[model samples]
Target: MISALTIENYRGFKNFSMNKVKRINLIVGGNNIGKTSVLEAIMLIISKGDPQTIWKIISGRGEIVNYVGIPQGVIQPEISVRHLFHGHEVKLGSAFKISAIMTQANKSIDVDFKIIEAKQVDQILYASLPSEGMDTFGPKIALSITRSDKKNPLLLSIPLSSQGTLKQNTLQTLVNINFQQFPNEDERAVFQYIPTTSLTGQELISMWNAVALTAEEKRVVEALQSLDDNIEQVAAISSPVIFPQFGQKTGFIVKMRDLEKPVPIGSLGEGTWRMLVLAIALVKSKDAILLIDEIDIGLHFRALSSMWEMIVAASNRLNVQVFATTHNNDCIKSLAMLKESEISIQRIESFDGPAIYYSADEIRVAATRNIEVR
Candidate 1:
């Protein structure tokens, strides 16, 4: 799991840091407070220096520049991650290059790069850099695209801001999965990002059907049902992946035990669909990092606490590290309830300038005082 992350000069954030992270990290902030930017920074770091991968991370979800085009000044988007790579503690940071020539603005942004040894295990993390003086902090070579007969560049490319180098196909597949595994046909056509290794068609159905409905699932479902008396019982579907039927306008599928039939998931209610998505995401994201933006979306305030209980269980059971963002006070309260030795909460708050993080205890205090740091 990544214990810490830092990002600089990316979108709304000048600098952001999260430290002392646990298995499950929750980010809470108001709109435009750079909550999603943190996730984008992580995706960029993991993708290495691939141009296409960088574009995917920055362009989607309205992160890209608008009609005015790319920003003129320095584009020093940097990200750092502290995690166990191959069971050894390591820190990785990546920076991208931006030129002054993009606009008439005096963007004398000479890139710098360097590498150095660190003193702490998960702290004081830095990336390995080339020998070139200050310009070795990231990849020495900046990527750019040029037409066959043109002398100048056609597109200025910002390389992947990941820790180390990764294969193009490997990085693409990872990005595809990060966005979502259940992209519709049209979504796939634009950017499929799906790996051939991922389960498909009947394979997905078979896997869901074969799931034993373990004790953990039972516990989770019971907790979910407790939130709503209307819910009779929640059961896993054994046939056909339960997903949004795009053309039908239903956001999910529900298999009711009474009728013993599949029904439109939207008819059930938003809370049910949210729980089901979390459940499926937990199961599918084993041994991987799951990034959830605005996790409180479409969730009922009363059910927020129960949803977090299941989230904690999923993280523990699946070896998955969850990084979710929320602006809801109830959501933060639910996270505060999770204070075991194994589970922890890290609250990221953005102030006037840099973003700071608080541990589980600090967050509790802040929440108690009715502070609005985000």
Candidate 2:
């Protein structure tokens, strides 16, 4: 688990730090105080500065800039990648960094990220391609990761065309440092980020496919059982021709004791669907990291306690480290009530100073006493 984290010039934070991290971290803060950005930084580090992650963050914020008429005139997006920085400016020498210290027993790995202008990025991304046709060589950002031996760091190429950048696919192509492909046993890590208000049946199905029939699937079913004990089974089906009646929306199916034939998961309430995706994500992220945004999106206040209870047990059982965000007071209070020794709350007030952490007791106090932690 991460023991400490630092973010510099990412999103709305000029410099932010979260120390003494625990197994389950609940991040709360005032609106626009960069609460979600901290989760993004953590996910990026865990992925070792993955290009898909970069695009996910930008796309989630509606920062992708689509082109108008020019098909191949070699033009970069009008909005530069600098928007991720402190002043929203990205000169040739400008860069932002995210680093974390992961600790287990007596061993630890230090993960770091440096986001800088493409020109400033070193030749770490294999032999440099000819810079001739590069899109005016503007201020495109390149992300590099260095957990150890910065001399041989992994470099990434943002997916946006060097010749011309459109809004779509702003960041892509993560090279080197895929821990799964490396020879070292200590470097491998599993990480997944589930964005807010974007959970879909198809996406949940795909995640389920990654680790189905294993102990993870059983944990998922048990997690959903928190919502209803009658939820005997859940399934993900693809290309249902004979069941063409399922049509294109035929992705998730759930079996309740009352139902004769299995019905589409959509027949359930939003809380069920939300819990389904959350549980799947949590289970598949076993012994790894799971970052969730707006974790309390579609659940009733009364259900938050039970939902968190199941989640906390699953997290402990599977050794998954979670960093999730929610703005609701009931969510916060319920979360505090559900906390074991594994949880802590980080309240992001602003970037003017470092992040402030609240103990589980403190959170409960704030909730019961009607105090404003945000």
lDDT of 1 by residue, 224-323 (tens): 4755544444443444444434422233344455666666655765556556556655665666667777787667877787788887877787787777
Cand. 2 Cα-lDDT: 0.68
Residue 181's lDDT within candidate 1 is: 33
Per-residue CA lDDT of candidate 2, range 45-101, in tens? Answer: 776665555556766777745534335665543324556767765444456777788
* Candidate 1: C-alpha RMSD after superposition: 15.1
Error of 2 at 283 (Å): 1.3
Model 2: lowest-lDDT 10 consecutive positions: 166-175
Off by over 4 Å in 1: 49-55, 62-252, 257-262, 341-354, 367-373
- Which residue pairs clash in candidate 1? 45-161, 45-162, 49-160, 113-134, 113-135, 113-136, 113-137, 114-136, 114-137
